[model samples]
Target: MPGIAVRTAAVLLVTVGDGTSFPTAAHLASYAGLAPTTKSSGTSIHGEHAPRGGNRQLKRAMFLSAFAALHDPASHTYYDHCRTRGKTHTQALLRLARQRINVLFAMLRDGTFYEPRTPRLT
Candidate 1:
């Protein structure tokens, strides 16, 4: 949630009036167009691709927020982790946005605000 400015938050809130309507984070991600698209045929399945449609405003907001979140240490670590797994910069950012959507869904479900936590050092 780090880099979620007032305007971005407003866009999200407006686009997703009530997050509780989504049963799970995946559902929310799908609705926001953050989930990857899949194509399937009879007995064969194709690889996942970028989603074609959903709430464009929310998707843009999430994308921008994820980009800004790169400045946060925790988010930066996650981005690096994605890159280590062979993801491109854009792919990693999208993945990060999806991850943040999960957290946002949880917050909406629990009616809570963003709470930064310290990562325990091993």
Candidate 2:
């Protein structure tokens, strides 16, 4: 939600409607084309690749949000973790977007707003 401007949020609301429509976050990601497509052939695994079909506007919103989230401490840490794992910049961003979708899904299910961090007590 950090990177989601009003316009983007509006677009997402219009395109995605109710999050409950999706059984899970993964389903929502697939609907938005954030999930990878499998490519296996001839008894060999060609590996997974970006999906070719999904709601373009939703995907765009997620991608942009992920990009903007880099400024967030947690998001920055996750992005760096992906980079350390040898994920390319684009791959890391996509991973971030997917993670965000999962969080969004939970938030919608619980009717909660984004929280930057959990409270801690000593």
Q: Which candidate wins on TM-score?
A: 1
Task: State the lDDT of candidate 2 residue by residue for 1-122, as single tens digits.
Answer: 78899988998899878687999999999999999989988899988899989999999899999999899988888888889999999999998899889888889888999988732212
Please give the distance, in angstroms, between residue 88's alpha carbon in candidate 1 and its true position after superposition: 0.6
**Candidate 1, 1-122: lDDT as tens digits:** 79899999899888887686899999999998999988999989998998989888889899999999989998888888889999999999999899899889989999888887643322
In candidate 1, position 45 carries an lDDT of 91
Q: Give the CA lDDT, 0 to 100, for residue 85 in model 2.
A: 91
List pairs with backbone clashes in candidate 1.
none
Q: Give the whole-model CA lDDT for all candidates, comma-separated.
A: 0.88, 0.88
lDDT for 61 (candidate 2): 94
Tell me model 1's lDDT, rounded to 2 decimals: 0.88
Worst 10 residues of 1 by lDDT: 113-122
Model 1 regions more than 4 Å off: 118-122
